[model samples]
Target: MPEVGVTYFAGTFVRHPLTMAVVHAALRHMRANPGLQEQVNTTAERLVDRLHALLAAEGFPMHIGRFGSLLKPEWTQEPAFGELFYYYLREAGVYAWDARPNYLTTAHGDTELDRIVEGFEYAVGQMKRGGFLDDVRPTAQLVTLASDRTSITVPSTESQREVWLADRFVAGNSLAYNEGLLLTLDGALDEDALRHALQTLLDRHESLRARFSRDGRRLVIDHHLELDLPVHDLSGLGEAERTAALERLCDEEMGRTFDLRRGPLIRFALARLDERRHRLLFIAHHAVCDGWSGAVLLTELGAVYSARVTGRAAELDPAPRYADYVAVERHFLESPVGQAHREYWLKQLHDAPQPPQLPPDRSPGPDPGLSAARVDVPVDAELVTRLRALGSAHGASLVATMLTGFAELFRRCTGQDDLVIGLAAAGQSFHGQGQLVGHCVNLLPLRLRLDTADGFADALAITRTALLDAYDHQGVSFGTLLPELELTPRRQSAAAGERRVQHRRARRRHRPRRSGCRLPHAGAAGRDLRVVHQRGRHRHVDGAGGQLPHRAVQRGAHPRLPGGLPRPAARRLRR
Candidate 1:
């Protein structure tokens, strides 16, 4: 049986005393409409029942009951809450409840209460003015799975809280910005032309105006808007100062959250660097954009900027909008394409091993609790020249050569003949659509199993083949693959009998560093060597207590060139 508990608010749920009066006034008006009252009653009942079931199934120690503005709670005696909670989640929209034990008795001072009432009144007014509830739903796509046992459980209250907080934080911090290398031109560019180009880009991408709201606890997106991209002038600051300002603007833009009661969740900022050089920063929440989307924006902006600078009309074609991609994705997921991919994954991972057994740590927190350390294996200029020569000799790209080096690194690190590392591919393959911004990238996990005697050239051949295969099958989304692979979370069993399968399953494989991992890139200009350090932290579940490997190393001169390599200065000047 599920436990039951009460939820308390710091004060009356209505916020201000006047707000309660307004609410009472609204309620009296609402009472005159029998149909509206009926709908509200039904919604409330459904919500309560769903909450109860969620608590019971998740084995939440408490159940919530509302009396007037106060919620009553009860504690659970059952052990397995995850199964039931997830079941409730799928059946209904409830993801979480306020878990703070003393919620009801908390005191909200007068100032806070006033703000809450004002917000409520504003929200109610909007709702009455044909503001649909769907407009306020969150825009999170539901990640589905195939096997029942594949569901990963949020093991504790803390874990659940962390997920909630992470979602909220991510939503709150999204911006209309694209992460790209900003280049400052030495000459003035046409601002009006630039604005026109930007507006065209915004109109072309549906993600630029995607709105988010909550569908129960899950986030749902409604792509709506024909928005104009705002442009500003910042051509009067030093280069360093301009970069600093752009970075700050990016941070600020990414940190905004949408309020349903407020008008729109869009923001833009521009910074000036000097008389001729200027920087443009665009930010949008992940609710509307992804990494691949950023690439598309940069590619388009480059083209548009170039066109304007050259005084040539932009020669870009009218490509499909992001909504088209979503429609195509939905169709693909439901059609033969999705099925074939699912079958492929099913066979590949049919006898796959369990997740890697990471080393344990003692951390008492709700953060992903994962950390990472990176090392750059810099190839000498000569070696780079040699590698380029070798690639040209073998008809391979620089990317292929890099893959070979990575495979070698993994082979040495894991001591395994067969290795696989997931690579994120920029999804810009759509014809006449490389520049359209949206979440078009997918992480393709490539397997590289090299024979111990294999040379770099042989490994490169295999890497090339694997990458091509991934590109061929890039139509399927990871959201669809997770389910068919039966990669759901498993419960930690206390009984010894349950340990056998778990231990056996655990020994079978290795996983990569957590998501958002990036490699450091080094570049050289004139007499100075510039190394760009990309910092990334891993996201782990709460109570997992996992520590990623960390190391600190000193920077040193570039290794000696392999052979016949031009000096760094000549190379820079040539570029």
Candidate 2:
């Protein structure tokens, strides 16, 4: 038998009444709201008028056309204007297609119109400043969409490539790229509900089901993979026995290595402490997860578990897929935007000085190069608030404020005025990537010069500017950036110069969003939040070693603590 022709079979599928019915309803609604069209047209005209003024002021040969509420913008002479303008608009908080027609609706108000005009101005100004207007840069390139749900294979992201390199670096330790989180639950546990929650999580996040090929050249994601939660019931044992067993389990899980070629990069184990307490442990390969993903996992797991136990449907927004992120990154590297970013980074790090060599606390050893010690200092909530205020006064974030303190201390330690420090970023500043679960993090080099005449406020301002600039151009990955800059990070083979301690601040200022699940605190289930201990690690490794040590400063503690020293001790040292 012969199969139906493509046109004949496809024609029937378009005759569905549901689409027509929706269109009819929309038309009816529009008829009822007779002023909708007028409002949209008015808004569009206002936008066009603003753009025309901006174009005339900037003296650019750009054309703007409008029919009713639909508007189109184009450059008559320069082909790169569209691409450069689109990116600049995006940077100015306006997301638009590459020189495509823009439609305005009744929903758009004056505020949005103002923002659009401002964005246009900013884009034009940037294009002029970048010398793009003077010379035609590369035209924008199109990116392929991974819409085929059957299977996806794309080149690994910069973050994933870095992880792969580190995994190879620490060849003996397979668990070098593992990230784990332990959540202590105090309630009547539900094993069935937990299992369902785990399944839902795995189904929602594609990164958890990701696997790299043996050659480590490509990342392959398997859409169909069933994962079971391994439960270890330690409730039968005595408190002491259960505690010891749990500790051993933590070590084992931490030490367990994943086979990147096989599959199942994430592991979940439930240990029931007793009738009222339980410990949930989740370990995932760093290739598949990051610091931000941990919070996402916890939030979603909590929501699903609560809904399943309570016999209600889980309410979750569809997660942004990792595949989309990979495709976008690939497109970026191949586009003019990527080239611009490369230029910016190169200029920023031109003739950059090497990091000062700090003396290691201990001598060299034959053991593997990655060794670190963790220290926890419990910071008072009041002091945290004060620190935040201090940062605000300097027009910076808490992290930036803390970074200033860290840089100053390092300068004092090494007695170096010029320094380059690696700052960790979540790398999710894109519109759809905030909730993505994957290795999308990027490390940016923060270079600062401190002089004896510089004060605290000067340092803070410099740090804030450097941090903000880094974030603005953080689209390019460090792995890709290093090669472009023609630089190689020194290896830390038990060498003091290769060892540097970076401070990673893990601050949870806000509680989880409103869900049925209760927040777990140290003492009670839902009392006011309290930071039990601020922990940080000190490690000596290469900049791209993939392992970041953390240290925290507890109130009233000695200045020599990890994470950070006490404020008084730091001040004393400064004096």
Candidate 3:
């Protein structure tokens, strides 16, 4: 409400510079077509026609969009929006503050308009419910976040530090390290209830609320006062349209990178496939959440959503904060055990052979940049069963057998019996660490030496031993051990610091797209390997960005790439 007798009540009124231009343009259009004026019943009708005509002038929308209210030092903060009345926002209790004019920028459109309209409707509903319409009347405002900043700083966990380094190395590639999860609700969902549940989940996890800022090399994390969790409804979309739109949304979400600082590192959306089906999406920056953290998130969301739909208190247990892991990691790094592990790693890698590169597909590219491509090769279900039995017969594990097969592909490619490939492991082996949200991944370089004379069974044993030994010394992060490893002559010294997350899968190798494993750009040899264990069949795909070795191509039993490159396949898949 405007103050009737207020003195020193500071406020600002901004005039749109283009108001007269539009009025003049409308009048000119009217004059140019006298017939239009003759058709109008009255002067008011003619003016309305002239007004619509003037709206076509270039930059006119932008000029009108600039209208906003400025305030004195006493307000100190920008209200919910540039032009919204401050008193109304205060009456409705919408949180907002800013020093800027909050201009409705040229980019603002239906998204901005809808958000403001929703806030207004919500405020009116509140007024009617509280019998306040007869009292101080509420006015329109826009949905927005509270602007109060929360001061929070956290120590980086060993895993977090590793991720930070990798994040920096591959800077500006958004979605480069994002984790995407798609869930389908096969029943009708209550939109209001689901939004409540999602908000509860966001509030439940501190990591979800966390934002990171780099203070030089050190990473700092802080919280936001209130987060805006907007829910989108696309339930009315036709099945085909919904599918296409959702695919585009997934790609857009997965590919957009996050600023670890200035964070809203996670995002979500919902599409109603029909009255009976709804799909939910969760995309989170890897710095704060990992695969394990996602599992935890789902578990909690399920409880929250269930209780909400049925009108019960969620009553979820307190979640472990990422900070907790940072504290544990700091102590571990300072302990004698940590030092011993580091020493063991250094000694282990002291005389380690350089990583073997897979033979290139073509001669080479003049440019030394990386490119990624994905292909799936079906494995024979029966062959997979036989391979498992073969492992059992040789007293070796199935994974060991698979690695042995992969090594054969390597041997065939390079005509060398000895090679080392990195495999991934979840490093949350300690007590109370299972539920923490943060990076807890470790990459292990498993070296295998197979004699051409030995049977496949014998090679499996060696691979198993290498894998088990690496498991025993899993505390040292791949980042922690990088300085101690020998590198091939072709490898750049600076590139040694490049932390390729080197995950072992994508048949979707059969690794989630957000696994963040870069397909090995063709180099001194094949750079990495991916194994897809699906059904009874196992397909070994190269992260090395090239064609398979000639002999391996000839040796493959089923499916081939377009150019006749052999795809590893088996007949049997097993437990």
Candidate 4:
């Protein structure tokens, strides 16, 4: 088996002297500290053993040099550059580590070059102050081998500078730390008032004020902001322009790294567009917030803003800090609750079908990136009412109805009775007090199998059952479940399979509709009944028969039935 050892200086793995020097230096450093010396020695010894094991397992030569200084002809053999880029991002708090060559090129235009230079200077200043690098640990992994057989040099570019800044500031903070927020508001509002409200909301939430940093490889948080936040106006721009700007800003911000040795590790931006509308973007390295934090920020911001605008004192009670949630989560993970949840997921998804096979790209290249198109299905008041009535009749929630509808569509498309699709669940369920802005959002994979012979109501019930089962086991992170489920992509071949099986499962599950609407009934009953349905878009399909017959079916009382099944119909609607 190949050996594993760390090298302080740049060299080939064959040079054992260089590697041994590094190991000796590390040992001396460890010995200097009575407590850490023991810990470091133990860790280093174990890591070396693991490295040897890894080499034996992969049958690949093992080399441990500064990652940035390593070079091999085969490095360009595959898309290894991308993989290495991500590896550096994880290990060294840097991004685009493989883009050294591209970064060397500078803008020819004097003005553009000047701007780039300014940005680079700002980035360098930030780096020095540990501005972006405040909470991040330093690593020797930033070194990169030259593209040609030449000495490695740090290349410069505006994009690279921004990325470097963000990576220095943000990445690897914490898995459950805060993710930024995207807020959209109605077009009639006061920008200053909104900003004030947001500030107040931030002040109220301990997580918003939390400070984070890296204590070596470990993340630590202090629940308070190091700097005051400033809100800016971002109104009167086109959607594309706004999107582009936000993307750029996000990219720049995400690239920054913070010095953990410093006090605070958080930043906020409020972009307003006119008096009535705006977006508030809060970018915190994960060490500070998560999905739950985003929702908490939104809810609290809304409430605090509303209160300030209306001249009412906010009455929110004191809630526990994010550290509390961490404690709770840790406890739950170790407790019976986590084990039970895991067991439930194991049972529920044991035989689940894979995710749908997305349509092949028509793009010209063989890029591995994804392209997506969305079709919006509007549920007007009347349609919403009808769907709600149907769901009510079956004692199902609106989400249950939609899930059933989607299940039918899936059956038609994949021709598989057993199917699994992902669902998003908001993780708030009567947890402790305080403004709960953290990663509370979770993805849940729901499995539904349709017995072809079953009626629509039966199918709906099955969907409802599955949804409820998912809800019951929703505490586990979808992030965790995804890997556990080992969901393979739906195969094109399986799309033609047909299983004529019938099974009846019983239960009451509450699947709430995404939205509810109240519409006046046209019948003599004269009831103003509320209808609930999945909020966003719904698919419309031509009935199973010909165009004219399909139109007739839509016009007829059974408009929803014909579109519920059949491959051609589902495909047409999906398209």
Candidate 5:
């Protein structure tokens, strides 16, 4: 071969720049962490050992093969079982290619490996029960949809349907679904650059331009939508005057509601604070956005603006379609697994307690015309740190611990041993749903029973168990569960809007400090972990400062100060 002269052609084009860069970065990371390969191999072997035992014990005619960190299923029975296994695996929250090996890496740790084994066990059991091994081919349940440049229409998801029903109950008052975010920038202002960034964001996220059908049965997303950025110049005014004007603008923006069927579910405005400072206000309907999307919108906006300023392309993954999520949810709802989840909820909530009533200053009545009365309860960092430590000691999260305390508060106020607390969860645990910018929050009812003999630790343990059970069965929405239990909507407002109480477990964001953009603090509420209790139709947990401040106002309401409570209790949670 060396003696013979041959034409050698190099295929340099095969290596794309992006691919090469990723490879190089990965190599560098591997070099920096010399034991990464060994760690990954160890995890893979652990998984293999557990899965091998599981398959042998379950008497499945299949085995798993592993070469280093690569794993694949080897079937001893019919080959068609591979396809059947894929569907079952997906239902168990494991996404993989049919009959193809999955590569494990340093990112797969003990928690992930345990989940893999559990998913395999669940998948195998489902296949055996469903008689999938008897017939590899059943009627396909997956729904595939096509869309053009004009619009993408998909059936409404349970979360979206809940919003629609809430809207109907409110008699089309859009404020019940309105939410907003405000960001303060401390640098040179660029109106044109901001405009370009806004347009790019609209183009990137289809949900921002989403519109509902007249009957609220479908979600339609336009492929292209023009940007409308309203800039309010307040730099010419005095500092005090500017502050007043900004407050008024926020109130006005929050007050402006959207017609779900008409158009424009989101609004943007920029206020010029000074030569070097600016504030950005963004408002949208709850149908189009949620707490998680707030972070996504800003992150993408920052990435786009940075790329535009540097004259380079923004590096972002392809936008995942919300319609795809709708299809997947519909498939689940029609499956036997969904029915089992519904049955679990029905049994658990059959004898649930009625909603607790908070003590009111005046008799509870309609106060639609009255302004919101803000209540601020400041929690110290030291107290929060101790509470978190207590939660960790008992294998509980801060959320569960706080929910226990919230239950105690209600018990003290209403003298009810049994309490039901509404918890709002961001239902984004699906394979491709993490990066999605749509409304997928599910409200859960957490029922807790308190005995006078129970200690704090015992109470927390009970709360933790209840919270975990709720999460496992959260696939069924609160809206769907209501009619199943022969119960009317828990929340009813004589006024046209929703009354919500929120209890949030806040933690500081640990990120590298950057100069371009930052969230400005709003007095004590921003700096402390606050608990807000409203005698309204619904109560849930959410971040405090990011939402519109005007919605916090409720007339004829009084804040239960520390001095107002019993002496012994004032020295407990609030302290």
Candidate 6:
């Protein structure tokens, strides 16, 4: 026999409408009218009787159980929340502590039914004398069906279309564009306030309340109510233990795949390590957000969190809904500027030189897995200064020098003088794109034609020119570039929602969405190394080397070659 205080339910709390109605209605009606004990009981009984009839008519088992007698244990689905509270009746509380039955499920038996009615009757009498009967109205939000919870549908932005198509081509792999961030905050944190701040963001940004799904062959997104933010308490653990556990948690959450098909797409966690320290992590699929958007989220979240703790409302700028981006994206894709940019990319990559091939630790059978190992090659302060000096002399910045160095690295690896690398540029140069949280990155191909006789200085010069030229046509989504260059990603496997890209040899270079690193493609038949510069650090994730060494540096012969240094210093570094 089940424990005496156990509660049971007949169906899922969410799927069973009648059970939900009975529970909610009982609580609401009882709270609103403590004087009408007899009427409340009558109403509850009538509701249960009608529910039983409806359930029985639907061929479900709904026989009444004997008082305090055990029946078959297969009729309920319990530990109903209501029953747990049924026993929470204080002498002056409205809830029927000893008499309320838990939720109804298929596993519930006779004793449960008797308890439900008894609990309701006793609770009504007690509540009439106390807590819930007090005249403060319940905080029920008044929302119109047509206003607050509006669902807006729109076509996916070109960037979304790009990743969605790539995801489809990966057979069963869902790693096309998922990205994450983990920030450790020093000082105290209030979880309740944190949750509220996050909720504020969700309310302010439509994309946060969005889901992506296919409407037949066309890709679309539907915006709905904001997702509930999740927080965890690990403040009880030791400082040392909690820090380790926090890292593991961050990894697990970041690596965890998102279901873009039915998405909140964004995942968040605030691990409370101690009263003075906390770690906050945010993970989102690239389709809903880009690198720039991630920073925007953090800045806004910080602003909101601070304002909340101090009792001030956050004055975030009016959020531009994701739908607006979709409309704007569509307009640009058909505009003259878009056409002009498209022409530039097409011309730039038309005869794109094959990327330099590097012998991988293993054969890259296919280029679709996200399993990666991080390789960090350190550059001391001296090297950084020299690189900056070189960049200044050449009228190029450190990023340009890095790009130039990478071009030289490729040439050496494959004995090829001409090579192409991918670079990610912010797509915010356009008006109205300054604050939206969605995919808005420009992936531009930096093609370099070199000669073996060219010195490091000459290589930087070529790279600097290419970088400047790239600025002219850096607005188009890289996904759009693929089709334009006849380099659509091939499907390793096919299923519903997969775009039919003709299996053709890749004619242009490809880059990962957020990681600006030039990706190795099937056209080369050999792996090409990629370099990702993030947060002032250059980390290489082994692509084909799906299993990157824990601390291996898959770098070129020159350790300082990893990052591009600026101009006259470029000459000094060459030494």
Candidate 5 residue runs with Cα over 4 Å from true position: 1-149, 171-173, 366-371, 430-432, 488-575
What tens-digit string does per-residue lDDT give for candidate 5 at 1-575? 23555354232546433665677788899999989988887787778777767766666655465666877664534334457787778888888787566889877888888888888888888878877666432211111111112355567777787787665554434454676677778888667877888898889887887877657887767656679888899999999999999888877887776877645789888899998888898888888897677767777888888888888888988877788877777777678987877888778778766555444443434422222223334455555556667789889986776677676655665677876566676766643477788887776766677764266778888889988988877776767776667443553320112334445432222111352333222221211113532221112222222232322222212344121322111111110
Q: Which ten residues in a row have the lowest lDDT in candidate 3?
A: 58-67
CA lDDT of each prediction against the hidden true structure: 0.41, 0.64, 0.52, 0.43, 0.63, 0.53
Which of the two candidates, 4 or 6, achieves a greater lDDT against the reference? 6
Give per-model TM-scores.
0.50, 0.63, 0.62, 0.48, 0.63, 0.63
Return the lDDT, model 2, position 48. 74
Report the lDDT tens digits of candidate 2 across residue range 1-575.
23544442212357543665677777898999998888887787777777766666666656465667877664434444447778898999988887566788777898998998889888878888887776543221111111111234556877787677667555443554677777787778888888889888888988898877545766767545576678888989998999899877877777777877555789888888888888888888888898778778788888899999999999999998888888887788778987887777788876666656553334445532443333233456666667677889778887887777777766665667777776667765543577778888776666777774267788888888888887777777656756556443552221122443444455342124342222111110110011121322111111222122222122212354223434421111000
lDDT of 1 at 361: 38
Residue 161 deviation, candidate 1, in Å? Answer: 20
Between the candidate structures 1 and 5, which one is better when assessed by TM-score? 5
RMSD of 4: 17.4
In order, how many clashes per candidate?
Answer: 64, 7, 27, 54, 4, 28
Error of 3 at 341 (Å): 2.0
Score candidate 3 by lDDT: 0.52
| Model 5 TM-score (2 dp) | 0.63
Evaluated at residue 54, the lDDT of candidate 1 is 42
Better of 4 and 6 by TM-score: 6
Query: Which scores greater on lDDT, model 4 or model 5?
Result: 5
Model 1 / residue 438 / CA error / Å: 1.2
Worst 10 residues of 5 by lDDT: 139-148
Q: Per-residue lDDT tens digits of candidate 3, residues 293-324?
A: 77666766777888988889988767666667
